[model samples]
Target: MDHRFVGIPELTAVPRVAVVVDVMRAFTVAAWAFSRGAERIVLAPTVEEALALKEGRPGWLALKDGAPAAGFDAVNSPGLIRSRDFAGRTLVQKTTAGTVGALAVADAPLVLCASFVVAGPTARYLRAGAAGPVTFVVTGEDGRADEDLACAQYIGAHVSGGRVDPAPYVHRARNSRAAADLGAGRRAGCHPDDVELCLEVDRFPFAMVARREDSLTVLRPVTAPVNPAR
Candidate 1:
């Protein structure tokens, strides 16, 4: 299967084996929540909808949209998910890029939520399913290329096999002086620990899958079947 690069919104037509990456924050937060014992997480496309979801499920924690600006509950920060006392409660997350990306790919044949932290497991999840073109649905900054796309590239190269190169993103990420300039503009969102969490490789073997019910997207964990190749 030939691998192709597409914008986040184009993930809808991707074949059954597609990986979703929100490395900068979203998936990292989801993984953190799972680690924190959150029963489940509802991926809402927008903050308003997420809030509405909380109304129906009183115990779910809320996270607003993150884009040009951080929304109400902050940009789905891992700090928030980890810091909160979410023993048995669920989290309702709405991110401008991640959630929108999830919505766009709602019809993918097999969608697995992923990030660098669980890149190895995500790859295992894809390979175990079947041989099909895998699209890394990376959520970008309001249609603009950002870290998420690079994270997707890394995971894609990891799972898809063949000669892989990382010089592209390593150079870009290292030289990205935008942090100096955008610091004033970049919203106070993801926590410092979150940055570390998002960068980890093979931190876990869980694959988060989205299940559409009525309108909201419910995230559920899918354990990789024991595979020595993984």
Candidate 2:
């Protein structure tokens, strides 16, 4: 298998597997929600699309700017969603980077949304299914987040059967300007608690696989038929 890492801005080919990396918050929240029992995650290209989705479902939660959209049950914040009971609810997600990145590569055969929380399992899953080209799309806040690319590199390295310490990259993320802004002064966009969850590497044992369902791309964890190659 040939694995390569590139920022979302540079992605071109439609590989066998396209892993969308958004460790900042979107996918971190996703991992938390799935871990806590959310049935599936539906990615919306924009707030408009997400709103349209809510119109059809009428009860699914909507998230905007990391907070629950008006009248929704929960927000996109992992810290917030982890406390809510989402046993069978399908979450509608719209975010700055994660979902956008996923939609950007809709041509790929296999699209997997991942964060640091599921990095190891994601790597394992990709390794098990390796048959050809695999590309890691680092969706970093409009191609400016180092942490996102760092995570992509981390996963890519692991996929190639290489070892790299994750602590330094995680440390860099903690002290990043974005982290500082979100932790010290922001309450609406992100907070310390949110960053904390995003940095929990390998917290989940499954990877979120995105499957296109008509107009929606749904993400669900595949946990059966373990086939770890290494």
Candidate 3:
């Protein structure tokens, strides 16, 4: 099986296993949310769909801007999840890069969202009998952000029977434009604590595996991580 790290721009045919990396905040928040007891996360491709899902649902939904909506429990903030309890709750998330990329490659047989938070588990999952080619999709802020690319490589190395020290890669992401976006103070959603939380590699031992549910993808944390693929 071929394991490759690639930017979204160069995508051609989808792989048998496609891992979407959005370390900036989307999947990072997802890892923390699952750890915080979130039952399941519904991936919404558009802001309108996310809000619509939350109309009569039990869980909350965040806007594409990652802001706290009126009826939502909290925004897509890893730091926020650190302080709240979303136990048994469901969350509808619509992000610019992460969700967009995940939906873009919905044709792939097995799709999972990963970030530094669940990087280790993701590697383990892919390494465990996931046949055919594996494509690591880096969901950059717009094009190719350094953080997501580094994360894609970090996971790719492990799936390819190699190891990578995350320290240097994390350091590089800390100085990337995506990291800078969090520290900019221009966006209300980005916080210092959130930035720190997003960079904590291997913080969670599970991966949010996405299944093709009807027209959209629904994500749930597979504790075994590898079992989801097998």
Candidate 3 lDDT score at position 196:
86
Q: Which portions of model 1 show Cα errors greater than 4 Å?
A: 9-14, 65-75, 142-146, 162-185, 226-230
Could you give candidate 1's per-residue lDDT for residues 98-162 as a string of tens digits?
76777677777677777666666666666677467776665665434556666667667766683
Candidate 3 global CA lDDT score? 0.78
- As a whole number from 0 to 100, the lDDT of residue 111 in candidate 3 is 89
Tell me each candidate's RMSD, in Å, in order: 3.7, 2.1, 2.7
lDDT of 3 by residue, 1-230 (tens): 57777667767887788999999788998888788788788888777778888886644654345666665556666776676677888888888788888887888888889999898888887777467788888888544789998888888876665467888889988998877878775556666787888899888888778888786588898864443432
lDDT of 2: 0.78
Clash count for candidate 3 is 0
Worst 10 residues of 1 by lDDT: 173-182
Per lDDT, what order, best first?
Answer: 3, 2, 1
TM-score winner between candidates 1 and 2: 2
If scored against the real structure, what TM-score would every candidate get?
0.80, 0.90, 0.90
Quote the lDDT for 180 in model 3: 82
The local distance difference test score of each candidate is: 0.64, 0.78, 0.78
Model 2 agreement with the true structure over 1-230: per-residue lDDT tens digits? 57777777787666677989887778888888888888898998888888778778856877766544564556667776777777887888888888888988876788888888888788787778756788888787656687787777778877777456889778877876656666774646555587888888888888888988886789898762254655
Q: Which stretches of model 3 miss by more than 4 angstroms?
A: 58-64, 225-230
In model 1, what lDDT does residue 120 have?
A: 62
